[model samples]
Target: MTAHSRNTPQFYLTAPSPCPYLKGQFERKVFTHLVGDDAAQLNDLLTHGGFRRSQTIAYRPACETCRACVSVRVRVDAFEWTKAFRRNRALNADLVGLDRDATPNSEQYSLFRAYLDSRHSDGGMADMTVLDYATMVEDSHVRTRLVEYRRRGPDTAVNGRGAGPLYAVALVDHLSDGLSLVYSFYEPEHRDRGLGTHVILDHVQRARALGLPYLYLGYWVEGSAKMDYKRRFRPQEHLGPAGWELKDG
Candidate 1:
């Protein structure tokens, strides 16, 4: 293929599928390949424009009759530090999250399996194998990383790396504007520790430290209880027809 064609992304559409967030509704997605040398820049632009990247593809809901999926991003500087957020951080205080490369291993897959079994057994990725997990972590053309949350090891202070088996993992995309949490999972047995909430808290702090403005959290369906957690992070922006608009409460 010519360089010009490779550089210019081509968009496509998917066949209608049952909407995962809303009942009795169908969902369609408009997507394009996030490949070539300009992948990172393309990803950043698309994400800001309400697209989400999954490996080499960037897509968003294109449902003809539904406009429920709204793209969300947390304002790092103005995020609310409510009592519950502090409580969740204290609950998982003993753990440390070390940013690592976008490589997947057996341990992460094991945790991913347990998480799916406990929470998403009926979900789309319920039957993923180890190799599938690897592809999900490594097939990206744009920037990505894995933040592994683990128990603080003896030498944690010196090396900035955590210790022991992985308690939780977050697949992140490093964008020019901020960090995008592609996906995250934790040890099913440690649900009470609030690993998921802690991870978001950690990311929020990280972005603020880096002087980034927003922490992209993908789409939030207004009526979906499954996505209600995204609402807790205050001072966020929801992508609307005009553009990114601030949301209070």
Candidate 2:
């Protein structure tokens, strides 16, 4: 049972694996493939329904006992530009994000490898090879873009592109209603610059500029300090039993 008729996607459940966020617990996922002519439409629908995409697969946690993986999205127009956020943005003012087609390259992989080795050494993606990273970037069926963060060059104003080595990268999906932050990585050595927060902040302004209402930020796992950063970008709407509910800053 791979797919159903009339473009109805077939759903499958993954076997339980050790939970990454919570110790002594397991994690399972219900997922479907995003393919065919309706891939983008299906992705839009699934993401709104609390699913997140990896390559061409759309999945959400199916852990029966735990419901901590909460889908979160930032309201672009209602976003709070707090003093801390302002300072963080100012800190990375010299860096610029250049949006390009979702094509994987060696340079991006090098940065990604270094980031994983430094910060997420024991995480799931720590063992991913260059080929895996390339597939992750290029295997998408829906509209996706890679925003490479680099230092601003002398001719940045003329060409509208960044300069120098890559410091951070964000894999984003352009949905019908919003831009989804699929995955992001940064140079772990520059921890003081808050590159992760900077990427999200840049996307918030990008969403506003594009007249998009939301910036889908995948999930926010409760009690996971690693997931706590998602909380700073407010005001955000958390998807729940009643759908997305707004939370104040």
Task: Find the 10 residues in a row with the least total lDDT in model 1.
Answer: 1-10
- Per-residue lDDT tens digits for candidate 2, residues 1-249, read 555485788899999899999887889999998988999999999999999999989999999789999999999998899999999999999999999999999999999999999999999999999999999999988999999999999999998888889999999999988999999999988999999999999999998899999999988999899999899888999999998899875
Per-candidate TM-score against the hidden true structure: 0.97, 0.97
User: Over 4 Å off in model 1, which ranges?
Assistant: 1-4
Q: Encode model 1's per-residue lDDT on 1-249: one tens digit a residue.
A: 645577898889999999988999999999999988999999999999999998899999999999999999999998899999999988888899999899999999999999999999999999999999999999999889999999988999999888889999999999998999999999989878988899999999999998989999999998999999999998999999999999876
On a 0 to 1 TM-score scale, where does candidate 2 land against the true structure?
0.97
Q: What is the C-alpha lDDT of each candidate?
A: 0.94, 0.93
Residue runs of model 2 more than 4 Å from their true location after superposition: 1-3
Question: Considering only N, C-alpha and C atoms within 3 Å, which residue pairs clash in candidate 1?
Answer: none
